[model samples]
Target: MAVPAPRTVRTVAAALSAALAATLLATATATATAPARAERQHRRPPHTWTVTEAAHAPGARIALDDTTGALSLAVSRDGRTVIEPSPLGILAQQADLSQGLRFLHRKDRAVDERYRAKSGKRLDRRVRMNETRLSFATAAGARLDLVVRAAADGIAYRYVLPAGYGDVLGETSAFNLPSDAGAWLSTYRVDNEGRFNQYTAATAPTGEYSDQALFATDGGYTLLAESDLTGTYSGARLAHTQGTGTYRVELADSRVHTDGSLTTPWRAMITGDLATVTGSTFTDDLAPASKVADTSWIRPGTALWTWLAGGRTAGQSLGAQEAYVDYAAAHHWPYEAVDSGWYFKKDEWDVTDPDWRTDSWMPQLVDYARAKGVGIIVWIHQRDLDTPEERAEWLPTLERWGVKGVKIDFMNSEAQSMFQWYDTVLAQTAAHHLMVDFHGATLPKGIQRTWPQVMSMEAVGAEEKRTNTAAHLTTLPFTRNVIGSMDFTPGGFQRVGLRPNSDAAEAGLTVAYESGLQMFAGTPESYDQRPLARDFLDQEPAAWDDTRLLAGSPGQEAVLARRSGERWFLGGVYAGAAHTATVPLAVGRGRWLVQTIRDGADGLAQDSQVLHGGDDLRIDVVADGGFAGIACPWHPGVTTCYR
Candidate 1:
């Protein structure tokens, strides 16, 4: 069973009231209950002494040295060290006070909290954890508390600040692996849509906003990211903490002020083997529980976006959008996101474009989609709603027209001011019952928990990556996705890369990636040209009940398996090595008729087989090619291969 979830304010207040009333009624006629003075005095909270500083993940420990005050990590392979010494430090604007911080008191305890996740690779219906908290104070009247949580899967920690704890500047929390460590780090962009680049830890770019840091040591692989965001605080990025030979947490701005108590987000580090790194759930682990009162409207499914499908299809305007609607209705996709130029004349940014504000056919389009059992969502530039009045002028009209959602785009920065505006937009859209998708935005930071209506964000280099390759495809499942929901909008069923195979390769992304809204980036007409490939695309799902990293690694190749309801779907890609692909069936124990799709005999043809799932299954993969299809409980007369 899932633990209690976060709810709207009123619901929380009501629950508290009911509990208070129950307590009053039960004790109203009874004598006051009290413990003996001696017993009461003796019952104090648990304490830990001589634990001035420490770091621990299950079955591992890195204690802080008293003389040096360096809190660092070390990776060892069977007693062979793979990392040089490094440290984690808390820094503030006041230098003397920063040095004054030291062990003043300590408390530790075991903890287990279970909660349901709204959506992710893993359901996490129940979360069990053990925590240790240490408190430190400076002579300058400022104090900082570190809360560390050790779970079987990963380790997470954060700083807790009491009221008037002095203004914190930032932290030195980067994983300082050996200088020679292999790494996969995304470019540091304010837009955060940069592609993953392979390099050494020493050569990884700094002085920018790279939300997560991932690297490989001879000891093991480690992935780092932040979670459980505190709204008032500015978001974080990475920068060279000069002379330390490591990147450090750089708060977005110098205006990190607090009037009352404030807690920083958890900086989580998931360290282990390849499977452990790829399968880690530390990011979502630190996310706050779902808080929406009624989440039925926040549905997950595939979508069709016109911008990705060549804005105007076959020289048809309204016909193009109608075709998109028809495609959704035919394939069971729930929504269609009609991108820019819907209201404008191809490239007009004016809000009052004659075709838009006055006589745009958006209302008629919405009505047409409704008749076809499809919901229509439109896009807008963030500048159009720079003020409340501007938003009021159109948000109501769109809602009245039965528009299902809106995609706000071109928010290319992560300044504190932009952060404030983001909160405003989320609240405003929810008030008007408008689901939202953020495009060209900052990396997600737990706002989805507070606002479930946020479907997905385009903080990743997806189909827009004109230079995309298999290396990029294989790396994303471990980096960009580890932080939050991404609008990959995958599926380009053609040989558009540095390889001969395309259909099967691109098709694999359906299972390789997860998003609340999985919008495909291809024309319906183009996909329809390839019927079998089109059928395969039609069956892909956006969310899953469970996810497994089946085989392969970052950059070279990868295979992923995801489950939805009773059926299972698997997708895998082999960049340049054509070989036998091994798939592990971790689902229910039964005879499953796996109608598989694999690279053709010559790497151009598509082949299929009906295999029984009693043990691991292997399929032929062509060099620079891939495969993806589905499996279900064996039934009569299922087709093994497509004609």
Candidate 2:
């Protein structure tokens, strides 16, 4: 073989020698010097070469620089500066895959459009996608890639590491924002035990992690979020960077195991009008395709939760749960959730205890509920799901005993270990064809697209906390529920909101919130006391075919319209003062029966009218109250045209 030229050999030798000397120097100073250690730990190796690969969509473009591995995204239709070329890289134990990496070849492809989630807050998201991959060789000779995608919704990027084992040290790249942009950051815990905190980007506290960070610009909004997280990765947080409005990604835990090759969760930056941003369905689009062979068993419906009624029961025991099941049966609910303390081992909630609590109560209740056509879902603590044996042993037993699902609770952290464990819970439960609902858990990130059996996650600071306000209820559709299913337990019709005269927010919540399994949290007997309230609960569903935002903003009034099958449900909520607005309908041709219920002098007022498609119906919501009801055409097929 022919040898390389002298100049080329000299260049290679110089690079290798420099890299070797720097490594040696870093190791030499690792012993005693703190500054030296910090420098070695934080310093990024410099890159000497550069090239850019870019792809454009209808209104957006994403460009990746091979030189510094920075990704710059632009939403150009509005002529606004979305992101001004942000550095994108990773830090790992074995290699600083950040900067100072040699560029390799790249490949580009486009994802063909397809439709899923037929309708919800959107008609159907046509998956228009353009993807590019830039390969690199780190200074330590490790291989990695920056995979970028430009879609109709926004731009997404992820790091692709070769099959290996090590801790993912951190991020080398950050999202730099314009100085004028304001942020809407949230500190609401997915767990039921926390308070809600919302603030702007610049004033956001350092070191705290927010599930969703929204930056509002003059032209539109910019969203920084993550999705499709699996067992290989931990939950990620958007942290405030030192710069005026810069933010960076921080993994709850960076230690990762790439079964062979690993693809990090998508680092997404979505931009557009409130409607565009709110209606975009990229969270589901970016997730892995479903792995289940038979998803027919997966069902979505309303259920009754027993835990929140502890205040009513005062004493927790088997009789209280049976009473809830009786109401579920009477109301025609599809399921009932038997909350924690159903077993002897209250601390660890995995399975049956032969000696202490394997009483006939659970079996009798399960059989009774099943006989009544209502399924049973039991609540279990997360601690019991610590191992494969634990999962393997209990889930099958529950399945054999006719338990339909499990509300897995107490996942207090979003660390990498929790991510793996969460995956195990879903997979194990799915293997037995059982559904799941997560409580005391991290905000769910698009995993439901892969596992629809995961009905809902309790991530919103909702009614269950008893601190929910009209503002909180109104803000959810635009923030928390906009990204994923929110288990905002409703139906305590007697009271509502965090302020006075708030009783009217209940019906609005039942109609506004989106979840696969809607579990009403108050005593079932309390609901049965009022026929109108019980009737509304019986007529409602958990998930919908289509959803549309009608009015308001965060912490303000909200009017939303949803479609299930062919029927339409609309609801609105407001606080501080009385509200009235003319609502536009997107329903197609022909007239329909519009039955509505709003706040009344004493309880609730109900009215009915014939409404034609494209009608602008004006509604008056009194102070501290809301509205909710249905609109269905007398003639179904002819009136159900696309809007």
Candidate 3:
């Protein structure tokens, strides 16, 4: 039987009441439920103590040498283990425990031979005593330790960073045990890079792309490494290979078991001091506290930009500004985006030089946009801010222009150094009170939780380039979007003429599934060509206040529902072939005005049909398919609730 859905929160007071109750219960119960084992565990000598009893069902216990900061974690079950040695520390180990052996970090045959015996035998090793330091308890009441050691092969040496690198630093080992393990491992890393591209040849184990083999679990628990980037590696350079030396390694010998529940803790890496290395080569700077902000603005039915109606050159010539203003005035679209070439010279690739001043017409454009109710977002290039001075100068100017957000393109990914750069950009943009959209970047790493103003990013190949397939769109939400919001410029009016299977409606389906800040890619003239399609565009929401995952997973199919005020908007896409899904209307119960956009049986339908809420709705959809449903409260006296 399916689990009953949780009740929806209609008001802030109700949410606060629930939070207060939960906090009180936790405070009251924490003092009464002290474990005798915990007391005994705490009593052991700091240096010699190791966790013997499992804290939760599937837990890891750490033992650090008092004299030496050498550390080791005993996993109750084997899976992937990530150990952060110390602050400013080298990677200690990353290995799969299911095989019951320490996996080789690199597969360079020549490098591996030097570390192994003549008989190809492995070696056992111990930490050098003189290079170790161990201490327990700090002002923060966290542990600290380190170990300077060489791998068994001796060719690769490492210095482990001490624990307590952050306010709270610990290790995590996630694996499925033979039985039910209630909890999961709690290890996470901060993503320095913006998006995940392909593995570079220099970084790849072989001279070709190599897929990291992870043991699949049937009923077992699995540990998924989270990142903040996206895109295909078919022809791109492998950016990940640069950090192979510093990648996390695990050492273990067994597969973990689970009770058919996904038990993995979401992790966030905390770095510090951005201003010190604003444009420096040192990429280890921590994310500033200011970057983290509240995202409660996301409620049930908020609207984000799906496209800018008048910013494109074609739109300008055809009076797109007037069209968009009229559309917003008549229909109630919240935001619009001003795409590339506005800040720089039109049709020119150079991003740094502001051609807007010389091109007096640009200010008129921005002014005209503001005159309308729509918000304006501009495009930017990261390559322009090659130096700190440039970043300081350009960012402030963007804010002065009264721009709502800036989209940064062509970021450098791969290597720990670039990771620091990624955080720096996000921090600097936030300081200016401007939203950010990262293109050619890696996946999101919970930065949204810290900086809610980071409106959206473009890690995936969105609709702008006119190359993304329906299948690509279907798979993204479950995988990339699970991390955070994406700026997949949806609502493209231009259709690429590919094969018969490649059609514009398929593109529309892709847009429907994306649940982030939306942008339109075609000209206003092109959009107006199809009246029905234009109507759908007019009614679409640009931002979402709250988001919910209704069903599906990465690279397969998924459904998402976003809330803005009392209205609920939902969209679903299927990536693998064709499939059908049923979504529950828990939040849609009170009353709703339903709007749906789906691929018709003939596969050419663009506009969606509207329906009033009466009985609960049931929808049947096909593969490479799309569906959007909007629900609003029903009113007796009001004739039209929409507006």
Best by TM-score: 2
536-612: candidate 3 lDDT, tens digit per residue: 55555545445455554433455666565676666666654544455555454455555555556664353323344
TM per candidate comes to 0.82, 0.83, 0.55
Count of steric clashes across candidates, in order: 0, 4, 60
Clashing pairs in 2: 119-545, 121-547, 183-201, 469-498
Every candidate's lDDT: 0.68, 0.69, 0.40
lDDT of 3 at 500: 16
TM-score for candidate 2, please give it.
Answer: 0.83
Residue-wise lDDT of candidate 1 within 172-244, one digit each (tens)?
6655667777778776777788778787777765545376767777667767677765545677787753234
- Stretches > 4 Å off in candidate 1: 1-65, 68-86, 93-98, 109-111, 165-167, 203-209, 240-245, 312-317, 345-358, 494-501, 601-614, 635-643
Model 1: lDDT of residue 188:
75
Better of 2 and 3 by TM-score: 2
Clashes in predicted model 3: 60
